[model samples]
Target: MASQVDHRYIERLFRAYYSGEVAEKIFHSAPEPEKREWAFLRLDGPMVRHVKLTSIDDLHSQLDPPPKGIYYSLSTYEYPDYPMPDKQRIKTDVAFDLDADHIRGAVLQEVSRCKSCGWIGEGDVCRECGGEVRKIQLVDDRTIKSISGEVSRLLDRLANYLDVDIDRLRIFFSGLRGYHIHLEEEPYRSLDSVERIELKDFLTLDGVEIHHAKEPDSAIIRILEECRDVLSEVEDVSVRQVLESLVNSKDNPRHFTSIRKRLGEDRVLRERVSRTVRELCGVNIDPVVVTDMSRLIRAPYSLHGKSSLIKTPLDMEALEALDPPVIALASPSNNMVKVHVDYVPHLIWGGREIPSIHDEDVILPEPLAIYLVNMGLAQGLRHV
Candidate 1:
């Protein structure tokens, strides 16, 4: 059963939203879902449904009891009756979802509950029961740093590979892991599924061969730079020597071909180069987000109920300095509530680690308490 406080928190967010500017922006088109087409909302458990909105005022009225999340259909139909692709389909902005799974050395919070024994534990599995687990992981600061770097790479590709204007790009925190880069410009918004797939291929570097015939000079330079970066980290003198020789070759297609040939012959070296290229160029994008026009993304500036964090827009210029805890704070109240935690290895607050104990009462500010409660690390006592 859902707790009263949990339910009320969602209600408070909705009330705040109705009084804000973002809700007006989301329902700007005055979308109306008919028949097979509908707007999606995430309520509580066992509640995944759609509602039809006729006007902007209707949206305001409908969201009186705010939902945990809001996502409108990306696919737009001419008749507004069905989501059939053949019916003169309209626009879908180019979007990419980058997750923290690719981020290395980040401590991601995990709350797993066992299917067989109903045992809850930290990490990906139930320690006592060893059953199949459902996990809810929180993105940490390290993850934000890693994903920000990835978004920078993506921005580079958007400009260089796809010939997109950098100004068209809008970056937003997922209110959880990583960021969403939305291309809100002319040609990109009009790009069809096949064209978007082509864009996806370019961003993901899928089927890109590092051969003389197809490899570009810019790509060659990127490969050489990555090789240099990996070689510098390597302790083996022989491996470094081999990589140096290959990377220092003539800056041409033939040299790149030779480099590929040499790297391919040695399995260990090939794997190393592959990992480096993947790390440098590959983006962890949810392909369905880009491919499916009917897919719904969490609306920007909306609250992520699970984390109690706003899916806030970010300035790309200062991505490295982004602080997740600071970004998650939407509340002004400093009132602390004592929480009964199940288990959490460490708690990061105000950009620093704080004292915490498993299965013990720990007092935290309202925002942090909401975060911990949502993450399943602790339960906020109503009277605390």
Candidate 2:
């Protein structure tokens, strides 16, 4: 719901950035650029799709006033500019999207804004004017850090377990929340949608089955061992004892019957164990992104319209010490801008905590101002 002025101002900023040398450098770094179909989310909200940009100049030409968001197909096609059904897909890079919102225990605040009276708070209706409201989820730093840990785990699994070459993998911050991993190597690129789903199942353990045989699956044993603390939270003392005994049994077939019996008797315990296995041993990734052969992903170094932050590429070392606020620092400007702060959830920026604000004028760095305005939490006034 950003005002027209705010949208135009943000678009101007993006246009300037996209025209600069820095953006050129980043854009050129993209792999196989001409093979993917490009798409843009325009400032006025329509999408321009199935476009092909063969060079940096072609890309910049499309920027004009600059689009809010940029994206490219994961699959390389023979005719990158053609419509989806008509285009012949050559191969698709395997990709994974890990979002902070999908992580358990993420702190979320419901921020609501009334459309009729411009009143903002937390609820379905406005307190001041009793008007219809729109709500959005705001996450804190803890959630981001948790997702970062998951990213690390995923990288480890990809490199060590799946034997993916380190050189072929690319990591990027999605700019809004979470990370995106792209595997551009052979075997992975040629995998069909079904094969991709099988890979997703391996990583997330989405449909893992527990057998009632003499020799327990090593994966189940690993899950039980790793989720010992989670199992301890089971309310039934007998169930907890059985799980603990099973974990100590070293994949012994003798304990399987007892554990199975206990699980069959208590539905809650069965559910708890299944949930724990997924939470502890599996990566919480967007399965659709992994399985979809024709997925479109955020273009690297492109600005995320909602946050005005760049979809930044990162090395393994850089990812280990990544700070969410630092990503915003990569935005085009840092100069102060005055804006009417209508309402904002509690936010952390530039290593400082900003308390929620409502109905006041404040001077903020240009990047922060653009972010707030783009998110419809503030209205632009003028440059300081």
Candidate 3:
């Protein structure tokens, strides 16, 4: 059964957070503060949008009762507080969102619990009462690493293939299950929706033509070398041999025509090569996010309502070494809290392996306790 969230406790935490140094950091990190549109999701109400703030003091005053989630626009505007049609767009940064849910091989942990008997176990029906079961998804290390690899690949492609300046990039852990990369540099910033779509297609290798080409492209060559394991599964021994030869001589441009002809005749081999190219070389990103000019990204250092984790900014090194438990410590807390766990998956937090618990009261660090309550895995008891 899913536990009821302690809304009062979470609200108190958010209120305290906005009055501190982190809120100041959020204001300072915002680019073109006056030109960017701000939006806030209230704890008990709908989202408030098209807000414009001029200074840090204004930001503090506006967040008198801190919101559940905060966001700023990707595009700078002439009249930021106006409605969409009236707000004139000056320029917009190129942004990409890479999420674990979108990644091909990422695994999400699931736990099921019964509502009627308070039974915590796997499957659709409870063993104890045969009642309905509720399933919950939890973020794990495997998913994080998988998404991180995609981020690294995106950064590499932006710098090497697209000629984007690395200095203009701003990367952030999206507070839950993903990373956001924003390119604020020239040429990229001025690109329209149509142009951004083209850029998205390039990065994802969408509609890329591999067969019937005069020469083997870099994408095909890369797939041949890196995806040899996949290619080896080809049923035809002769076709497999041809692919292996292509892998061995990937650098030699002379072998391009012969290999293309051979692979083109075999439909299975052609399909395999196309699929492998996208899977291995192309980045997995949200196409809608890439093309949307007026998108609102999570405000850096703000708390995510669902995860109770901050939307943290990152450099390459920080991103590479990201540990979720360590990051969870950043949530405002110096005390402990008591919580009633309905069920939680075996998870490692604060360098300790937390075994799966069922209907037990546990004392945890404020951040962890809040995380559980927010995630619907536990109900908050009291400050310990």
Residue lDDT tens for model 3, 1-384: 123358877777788888787767887667787899999998876899999988888788778788988889989999999998899999997888988888876766778768887677777788989899888767655556557878877887788667897767998877767788878888988998888988888788776656555444565455446456666566666656666766665566677667777777888777766665666557899888888988998888888887666777777777777654434434455667888987777865544567888889997766667767766678855777
TM-score of each: 0.77, 0.87, 0.86
Tens-digit lDDT track of model 2 for 1-384: 777777677777778878777557645655688888889899888999998888888888778868888888999999989999988999998889988778665555668988898778888899989989888776444445557878876776677567798767888878767788889889999998778888898788786644332445565565566657677666767556655776777756777776676666777666665555566668888999999888888888888887777787778777777554545544556667889987776776555576888788988767667767766678964768
Candidate 1: misplaced stretches above 4 Å? 1-5, 12-22, 28-38, 46-54, 80-88, 102-107, 110-136, 212-227, 231-246, 252-254, 260-276, 323-336, 350-352, 380-384
- Model 2: lDDT of residue 378: 82
The backbone clash count of each candidate, in order, is 0, 0, 0
Higher-ranked by lDDT: 1 or 2: 2
Candidate 1 vs 3: which has more lDDT: 3
Candidate 3, residue 237: Cα displacement in angstroms equals: 9.1
- Could you arrange the candidates by TM-score from highest to lowest? 2, 3, 1
Candidate 1 has a TM-score of 0.77
TM-score, cand. 2 vs. native? 0.87
Query: What local distance difference test score does each model get?
Result: 0.61, 0.75, 0.75
Candidate 1's residue-wise lDDT over 104-139, tens digit each? Answer: 444576667677876766656678777788776755
Clashing pairs for predicted structure model 2, backbone only: none
